[model samples]
Target: MSQKKMLRFSTGALLLLLPWFGGLVLGEISNDFSQCLDFFYNTTPPVGITAAGYQPICQRYKNQYHFASLYNRQSRSPLYSAYVLSPADGKRPRSTWMFEPQLAFSRASSEMQRFQTPLDQNVIESQAVLEDYKNSNFTKGHLNPSQHQKTVEDRKATFTLTNIVPQKAGSNSGPWNGLESEVLNRFKAFCNGSMHVITGAMPYESEPRWINNRVSVPEYMWSAYCCPSYRSDLPEFLKPFFPTYAAVGRNDRNSGEEIVPVNAKAGASVRGYDVRRMSLEALEGILKQRLGMPITLFHGQCQ
Candidate 1:
């Protein structure tokens, strides 16, 4: 064939394959949650958590990317919500209290929106809706808190139900809240670059706890952060906190103290459900013991 004829044939074949290739690319984007991890500073998500029923969510609100969460449909809550800590200023945004529509409805897209009242009765049965929290003692505690976000839109995106767990009133309002505030201040003061954070829950070892038998109630709440880059000049007190730090907060007063010792000094309000700060390795050790599985929260253990 002539050179001109050969070039024309090649161009025609390329055009014919474009639509099929586009469809393939779209299919991969729609199906996998790991695709969203590109938003992370190092494109690293936590490892070693149970994979069963795990769903990855790239949180978007008002058409803006906010964060990513590893959601558990079986528990109707997030296993962990990961986000980069931004410089927070001004008042925290009001909680919009959204639910993941795509989680409950197959036809629904991964994009997030507010939960509809009189939820489509068909899909409502499969997941926990807002009504489950009504009259319940547990508060809708955030796994990825709004305070860590910088912008109003980013803060509001954290309100999705997939990122919430059934947290106890005392833990949510008292010690846990204090821990979150402390973390925020630490990140603001020391972290000079991107701060990667993952906050999650731990369920009971032997038996599963539930709210309205719909959402699984976590026995303890845990969080960890990796600040790969930070100020080299460090105060003596803040030295141990560099690179990585972690904590495990008690969610149930009735639970034993093998992992986190109860604080006698905390007084009546927040005595039992105390938050214990520890080295990242210590927290991972406790998780491994209780979860009966080897779990790593950061890549190379954030080293």
Candidate 2:
């Protein structure tokens, strides 16, 4: 079956099972944002990565589905953002940098206009406001990069602050960006099926780091992709990448290399922010150790 057809079938099955799956009504929630999970396959989101005060966000813009985010209220940043890859259209939209109203107000009372403005009395003052990133050393890094999506709208939908995290300039423009491009190129060339990608953050072990004491800074950034259908005749270098692959990139240069080791050849600018590619199982092992619990990013390891 084609990837498009498989997506349709999965969505249909979700709708059919929605009524009996849980007492929760799909569209009955007053907030339109509540329907965000409808974008996920079978309406099943990632599991085992959430922490206390973390909220799930189904990112929608202009009534179009974009991506899903697991946001940390305390950290005032996303734990991760999940989205499906689409063929690139070569048109990048300017970042509008919007906020999530539901993060500040009750879902029923949250207004669309709230997404455009900064909240004055938000419970989590650490919430990353646009002003916080201004003149700061770090860049507003995107977990679900705009380049992975196809349409203009899809690209723009990724601009919301809810889907962003603090990243160093070296990592954002260097090794990390290279990894995202590599994934896009591989999917466009070899994947004959849908690719579900989840990119996220790993916090420091003992003490938490902060960006201006507002948004929490991640110690490392990690990503994984699951492509169940692909050309069997992959090159030797690309063989282990099929079905599922994962990577972890250093976010802090001063941090220890017990997780992702720094690449000495990456140049002084990005030497410590090197990204390491590994298997799906290896990524999960790191997550399990850091989170103090077993966390699964994809269903059946994207079998």
Candidate 3:
């Protein structure tokens, strides 16, 4: 064939295969979704797992005796806390932590998809029903720190379903959020690598609230610990960001009482707390049974 004819034939073939090739590439990337947390469910494997599957990075551990809350509520679920003890990567201690590595949380939005069970979506979506539970008092809490996962990709990963709970706005975005930022900043200042962090939500008091057909109630508060600190490759100017943080549940709007226990563990020369250890399978089971419905995940500020 003439050179011109050969070139034309090659172009035609490429165009013909473009759809298949493009789809394959897209699938491959989507399949690479690996960072995930698990919950418990009676079903063998919970819903919304990626094609890559879910894996456990933390161990199941709890310590109500020594644990502190970022926010406090007069709810049974408020005091209970859980964490994952991630492997120390040479920089951080192998202490019990909450939140998982590379995980982040934000309020639900249309753009993000719900990764938990189908039941979560139904339960969480009812604004009017949940309103009584939400009460405009709580903040959509996030477990992952943005400073740790600076990149958009990693930050986006934190938006998964398993990493969120309702928190008082004063607690969620205030001191508790401040702690996450300070920890990451400190890790970045003194440590040598990326900090592996785990965060969790402590449930809060529930009013007989109903929002948009959803029985909305603040179920969890905040508790986070980090390990294997961050890279010390920070500019000196940013050093101001590394101050120590204290956890306190914010004062209640209605009662005006110091509801949250700020500095809950202050002046305590304690080394660390024990963590709950569970496999990915076990976590998934819990998520399925507990969450039960699908819930949306996202990043950034949301009302």
Candidate 4:
């Protein structure tokens, strides 16, 4: 074909495909972390995850950034959410779940917004929404659990679907939840300065799993923390846990017993969903294997 004819054909094909993969276009949640870098250990994101699928989101709510979420639009989930572990008072807020409007419209708004009645088609296509979890046999798991936030608004900001992944109920309310509580206990007991925590999901190796054909379900839930400063007089047992800590929880009962082994002695409700605590290096090695790249969760390994 002639050069002009080939150019015309290519342009036409692209125009037709635009609507099919409209959500792939990055709207407004941008590369800039200038708005909320304090959430990271040294105001630096984890190194080595340089794939196009991941986008940095400074989760803003009510005019302030409460945390940061490294979102994966293709997976319709967060790679991880980072925040300082603050004392959560009162109860889980009953606020409506929200989404990043910029994900749908480039100039819509920087702040997260609540899903509208019959949520906009663009919004629904751009990211996971409330309907994706309705009766999907999976729970909307929060990477940055509200219990770790300090204020009501900070806690409520975590309800955004961008920071969520489809997690099994067995894990959400079982071993994983227990791990969250344990981390809080540790923070309250020893951490003197800011205790930064990063929680994320791990996908199955062989094949992808999805809920509502829109959201990817995680195979394991992992978390790690860094406390730069703590009490000088530490107990013997807590020595190894100081400076940094890490863990991985089984999200699927049928999953292989390689990363996180199942506890046969556990109650029937949470049989295979056991969480295994490990060192920072151990967790990073696993992440490197799973993500096919090196990872540095905390700066200088929380030195």
List the candidate numbers ranked by TM-score, top first: 4, 1, 2, 3
Residue-level lDDT of model 3, residues 1-303, one tens digit each, is 999999999999878544323211122111221312221111112235232222332211121111111112122112222222222233322221122211221221212232322233332332111233344544444454333443343344333323334555555555555565555545544655322233443223434332223323443333323233333565876443322111323323333233332343532321111122232233334333444533212111000
Q: TM-scores, in order shown?
A: 0.86, 0.84, 0.37, 0.90
123-144 in candidate 4: lDDT tens per residue? 8888999999999989889999
lDDT of 3: 0.32
Q: Rank by lDDT, descending?
A: 4, 1, 2, 3
Candidate 1, residues 1-303: lDDT per residue as tens digits? 999999999999988544323211222223345657754546866667665777777786666668888777787877788888876666777767776655655545455666755666654665567888888799999988888888888888888888889999899999999989988888888888888888999998899989888898999999988988888988989989978999999999988999888988777978788999999999889888987768887788766
How far does residue 49 in candidate 3 sit from its true spot (Å)? 21
Q: Which candidate leads the pack in TM-score?
A: 4
Please report the TM-score between candidate 2 and the true structure: 0.84
User: Whole-model lDDT for model 2 versus the true structure?
Assistant: 0.78
Q: For residue 206, give model 4's deviation from the true position in Å.
A: 1.1
Candidate 1 global TM-score:
0.86
Any idea what lDDT model 1 has?
0.79
Model 3 lowest lDDT segment of ten = 60-69
Pitting candidate 1 against candidate 2, the one with the higher TM-score is 1
Runs in model 2 lying further than 4 Å from the true structure? 1-34, 38-43, 108-119, 123-126
Error of 1 at 181 (Å): 1.1
Off by over 4 Å in 3: 1-137, 160-162, 205-220, 228-303
Give me the runs in candidate 1 sitting further than 4 Å from their true place: 1-31, 39-41
C-alpha lDDT score of every prediction, in listed order = 0.79, 0.78, 0.32, 0.88
